[model samples]
Target chain A: MIELEGLTKRYGEKTAVDHLTFTVRPGIVTGFLGPNGAGKSTTMRMILGLDRPTAGDVRIDGRHYDELKDPLTSIGALLEAKGAHPGRSARNHLLCLAQSNGIPDRRVREVLDTVGLTAVARKKAKGFSLGMGQRLGIAAALLGDPRILLFDEPVNGLDPEGILWVRTLMKSLAAEGRTVFVSSHLMSEMALTADHLVVIGQGRLLADTSMADFIARNSRSYVRIRSPQRERLLDVLHQAGITAVESGDGTLEVDGDKAEHIGELAARHQLVLHELSPQQASLEEAFMQLTAESVEYHAHSGTPVSPQQWGDDWKKG
Target chain B: MATVQVVRSEWTKIRSVASTVWTLSLAVVVTIALGMLISALARSEFDRMSTQDRITFDPTFISFAGMSLGQLAMIVFGVLVVSNEYSTGMIRTSLAAVPQRGTFLFAKLAVATVLGLVVSMATSFAAFFLGQAMLGEHRASLGDDGVLRAVIGGGLYMTLIAVFSMGVATMLRSPMLSLGILVPFFFLISSILGYVDATKDVVRFLPDHAGSRIMQVVPPVGDDTPYGPWGGLGIMVLWVLAALVGGYVLLKRRDA
Candidate 1:
């Protein structure tokens, strides 16, 4: 498990990471989500003991990374895919990292085979494609069979098949009772792969909840009704706890009411309801709503800022 | 044993890189080729002299005459060894693998030191014999006084220069910048420093000045410093320590 207490980092005048506290439990894949410049990378670096925190501390398996007997075995990290010396051969590159962490030499070949890099192990890293370099980075991370793994943007530049492979690999590692924490800005993938979600924005924690709870608590439910007498239904829904408004077509839009509730209400009122259905919020929409604020370095383009623009302020419990 | 493995890892990394081979080869070729050309010209000058004006050319001098050019190439090779990690964003991986920064530095020192030793030895032997063959009459062997010391000193001086360059790389953390400053400062400026009385005191501590002093059979003309050959080389070693320590201090205090 990994834990952070009051952790913070300041780059000159800007506070990149604020005083934040959280825990990453074992036996599950925890996805860290944030907008660009949201401090996810900074936090991970602090966890790995690469960058010193301006305040507080981070611990892995109850000890700092430097205090671990063998850091590679304790925690395998793919901090950046382009982390190897470009001049070194793939095989020799892994060999050097393995040797530094006291890993046996056999593990080097095993990881190369696991990642399907054995074919190009003798080739220099400068020659490898981005995908191949990513594979090498993953191979190095898994070389020690670590109990805790940290992957920062691991799915970037991967093809569809490669993405699926990584998703499955993360799940399997967590299933084996290891702590798997992966960070990415891609919400679609996180919704599919992560059992737990840790969301941050503008250098502060926004949400720390199980995927199920997050969806259930934050998502919106609505009712859509199609009827020739849409005006009558609108008046009737207004009397009920649900809010209803006229749709562009001859239909009624009911807010905070499910299909069954609207149907029963219509039946009791003896109204002719042509259509009654529930509209559920997608995980993607819920995520946008939760992290509506704290986005830094916004891209100016034709695309609209997510509905999160509606939520100018966010809070976490 | 772990440190030994670290050293081995550093060696593999250095050898696998093509720059290591290219730069070291440049060190050898430039040293030998330049020595041959320079020694031949000096001998031609000796032959035309009147009998009374004959100034005997030192045999060891002509053989190791290429020290000036050889040192520059070795310096390039040394700087790249450490600086490439920073330029390519690989130091994060390196430090992550071996959390103990000291171990990493030690491994680099060992790999760079050994490679420097090997290249210097090759260039020394090749330049000495080739230059002697070029000198039709004036030839010196290892058996002569200070001839053995000078031959070994030539190689030793080149090795120290490489190590000194490694320290500069660590401090500067960029190959181009380190080599840019090191080359002109050592090759052009240090020798010129001797001409000005005010700069002479500081020039005594210049790495190439102290290191190049070892190659001289007798101190070069207009020399003001009192350091003998070994003591001068010792000053170069002192330079290596200063740079390594400076880098370490910076690495310790700064954010990774």
Candidate 2:
């Protein structure tokens, strides 16, 4: 288990993480969700004692990270894909980390097989493709067989097969009663993989709720209706004390389970119905709405900023 | 984190990379080969030397002349060993594994320093013997009064050079920036300063300048150096200690 209490980090005048307090419990995969620059990486670094927090503290397994006899055995992390030395072979890379934490040498080869990197275990990381590099990182994370695992954007540049493999690995690890905390900006991926969600925006906690609860609270479900005799339908709904929202294009959206009532009312009024269907908002829309204000870069059509321009803008802010 | 585990881990890290083998080999080959070549030239030119020049000529010191160029390779080895972690972003992973900053830094230094000592000692002895062979009748024997001391000091000098580079590299945290400063300062600036009458006093205190004194079996005639061999080495040790403390302080405070 990992617990953070009032954790904060400030880089000069700008705050990267603010008063974050949460617990990552074992036995489930917790998805950390935020837009770019939301401080997810900073928070994870603090948990691992990589970055010193400006305020408060974090404890791993009820002790400070440094106090643990062997930290990797308690919590394993894959912060980035290319964190390994490019000149070192995959097997040797894992071997070094394993030796540091007193993990046996056999664990290195086991992790290699687990991640399906045994074929290239002797190859230098410099020659590995993006997906292969990610696999090596994952293999490193599993080297100590830590109970708590933190992965930052683990699926960033992976193919469909690799993504699926990561998703299954996360699930299986969680099922083994381990604490699996993974960060990603991709909502669709989280929706399929995570059992719980801890979301942030502008370095502040936006939501910390179960997956079902978040979806149920954020996703909007409504009844849609369109009619050629719009005036008659409006009169019938007003007489029946039903409020209908006129969403342009000669259509109306009514909240709640009013589709059947509206249909019966329209039939009795003899109004011609062009379209009447229930509309449900997707998780993607809900995520966008929650993070709209915190989005740092606005994508303006026809005036697309080059990659270098985007980097410059980020530096300016 | 146990110091022993971290040391073992650092050993693996140093040995697994290609740079370690390449850099150390280059240091050995360059130092010995160049020393032999210089020794051969010095033997041939002995006849043309003035009486004063011949009187001041130290055979033991002459053989180790190649250290001026060879130490640059040692600097590269030291800089790469420390700065590669930062450049490749492995420092984050490394620190996370061993969160005790002091243990991580010191363990790495301990492993690298040990390797540097072993390789440098072998190189020093090999260079001395081969260069002596080239010098023929002018060669100083190991049985000579101060010859063994000078040879052992040559190994110590090379080891200190590499360790000093490691300390500076730790403080800088970038291989290119560390090399940019260390290479020019040791190779050109120190030597240039030593030749100028105005800068002679200050140049003697530089790490390389003071440390290289150990290889001198006989002082130059009429020379008045401030410190003796051990005292000069002491000055170099002080410089190395200061750099290491600065590096540790910075590493302890900075975010990985």
- Candidate maximizing lDDT: 2
DockQ each candidate and list the results: 0.62, 0.74
In model 1, the runs with Cα more than 4 Å from the true position are A224-231, A245-253, A260-277, A295-317, B49-56, B192-201
Task: Give the lDDT of residue B232 in candidate 1.
Answer: 86
Cα lDDT listed for each candidate: 0.83, 0.91
lDDT of 1 by residue, A34-114 (tens): 877889999998998889999999999889877776688888998754898887888988888887777899999999998
Per model, kept true contacts as a fraction are: 0.69, 0.86
Worst 10 residues of 1 chain A by lDDT: A293-302
Model 1 lDDT at residue B61: 76
Local lDDT at B149 for model 2: 87
lDDT tens readout by residue for model 1, B1-256: 3777678778778887889989999999999999998778867887786664444446677778787888888888889988988888788887777767777888988888988998898788788888887776877776777777777888888888888888888888978899899998888888898678898888887887777667666444455677888898899889888988987777666556
DockQ winner among the candidates? Answer: 2
Off by over 4 Å in 2: A248-250, A293-317
> To one decimal, what is the Cα RMSD in angstroms of model 2 from the true structure?
5.6
Task: Work out the TM-score per prediction.
Answer: 0.90, 0.94
- Reference-based lDDT, residue B6, model 1: 77
Between which residue pairs do clashes occur in model 2? Answer: none
